[model samples]
Target: MVGLLGWLISFFVLIALLVLVVYQLMCLADLEFDHINPYDSATRINQVIIPEYVTQGGLFLIFFLTGHWLLALLCVPYLYYNIKTYMDNRHFVDVTEIFNNLNWEKKKRLFKIGYLVATLFLSLFWLIWSSVEDDELGF
Candidate 1:
């Protein structure tokens, strides 16, 4: 059982994660950040922005707080996806026509698929871990 202090901390972290998600949504909608210089192609804000890190990290924290170690292991694959997405977007400015024409929509779909796979893996691992733990305890 998590203490009151832990619950409060988790709640605050969840709120912060929600705020970041909203900010990312605003960026995606192109309804803000009009002041950024278009000529400065070097600083691609979108390329540096991978919002899943926050969401997935928040979920991992929640799982850890709930003592779901096996489920929390999903963070590994989530981090991998985040790094891959960032790298794909960062080098997207390459002069090669192939790199320049990278499809962001497809990348997003792939990330979503990765997240889903991680979720499935987490569920399966958690189930097996719990069953093994139960057997060890003579359940």
Candidate 2:
């Protein structure tokens, strides 16, 4: 029971962290595009941004499965670096141009609402799966 509880706690924490990482990435994408071309039909943000989060999420899942708490913990720094790089790249353009192009209110609202819902669903799944006793059932 203790082992199961520990696993559940760890899984929930990892899910929360993964959701945060993904949400940060999405916000970064919004920031990146807001200045250059709000209407630009580029799927690069979705393609590149989402897959990176998925990969990290998969890594966390694997680490959780293997009970490698230290390895899973390292993802926090990795996620930070990913977002930092994305932000640093945004500085090359003129500040005035970027500011003029941005719709800050809309971007903020969209990111907050979308990310909140996504994180909620993801955390719920993690919580559910973590609570299940391995010996009790098959799913």
Candidate 3:
């Protein structure tokens, strides 16, 4: 029962990570028009995302096969950071208008700090969770 639960958790986490990577790719495409230009379409954005996704998938596979709950948990923050970075770069509003509407520097700083703090907390959780033994689960 425990092994089945662990597999399900890891599988769902892997799916979530894949979704985030796909979203990141869409954001990258939105930010960099050159990636879509017919004349310059050879750019390796898709190639890059694929390799990254594969690497993450490999990690999940190893964790699932080995029943390494900690290793699987560690992937959470790593995926979060990648998604956050993509979101930070892919602002939807016009930059000039956004800047004019508010203190752009302050907003940028706050956002940076927020993401940094979030990433740190997530990493810490992953580390702590990874240390927990499988049988330690409370009945």
Candidate 4:
């Protein structure tokens, strides 16, 4: 029973982390396009949101449902890359970068921090999960 509870907790936490990553991707795509093309900001922003949401949702959902060690193996590097990029680019901001500069700055800052933390936690969890015993769950 305790082991079952632990598995449930881990599963929910993974789902939350997946959702958080999706949110971060939305923000990243939004900021990138807004930086590249300032004129079509509204249209560009609107265009990317739905697709980003859908793509991340579907991808993470597949990963969660499959719940295979091989799938987790594939995601580790990607999560590490995101963590590295988030840390590397957290400070620098171009003058044209509107997301972190202007209104809702605090919110954007929090999201960036949260994204990095989530990625780190997710990667660490994967490492531990892989190294630990398979147990009965085969998670």
Q: Give the range where candidate 3 is weakest over 10 consecutive residues by summed lDDT.
A: 38-47
Model 4 poorest ten-residue lDDT run: 48-57
Please provide TM-scores, in order, for all candidate models, with all chains considered together.
Answer: 0.40, 0.32, 0.30, 0.34
lDDT per residue (tens digit) for residues 1-139 in model 4: 4434444455555555555545445554565556444435434444543443444344444455656445445555545544464467643234456555545543553564565366446645754565465554555
Query: Top model by TM-score, which number?
Result: 1
Q: By lDDT, highest first, what's the ranking?
A: 2, 1, 4, 3
Off by over 4 Å in 4: 1-39, 68-102, 105-113, 127-139
Deviation of model 1 at 16, angstroms: 1.4
What's the lDDT for all of these models?
A: 0.49, 0.50, 0.47, 0.49
TM-score of 3: 0.30
Per-residue lDDT of candidate 2, residues 96-126 (tens digit): 4543544553364365446445544654564
Using TM-score as the yardstick, the better of models 2 and 3 is 2
Model 3: per-residue Cα lDDT over 1-139, one tens digit each: 4554554554554444445444444433443544344222223333444455455556546564766665657656655654665567642333334324234423443553454354345444544464454436643
Show how many residue pairs clash in every candidate, following the order shown: 0, 0, 0, 0
lDDT value, candidate 3, whole model: 0.47
At residue 38, candidate 3 shows an lDDT of 26
Predicted structure 1: lDDT: 0.49
Reference-based lDDT, residue 106, model 1? 38
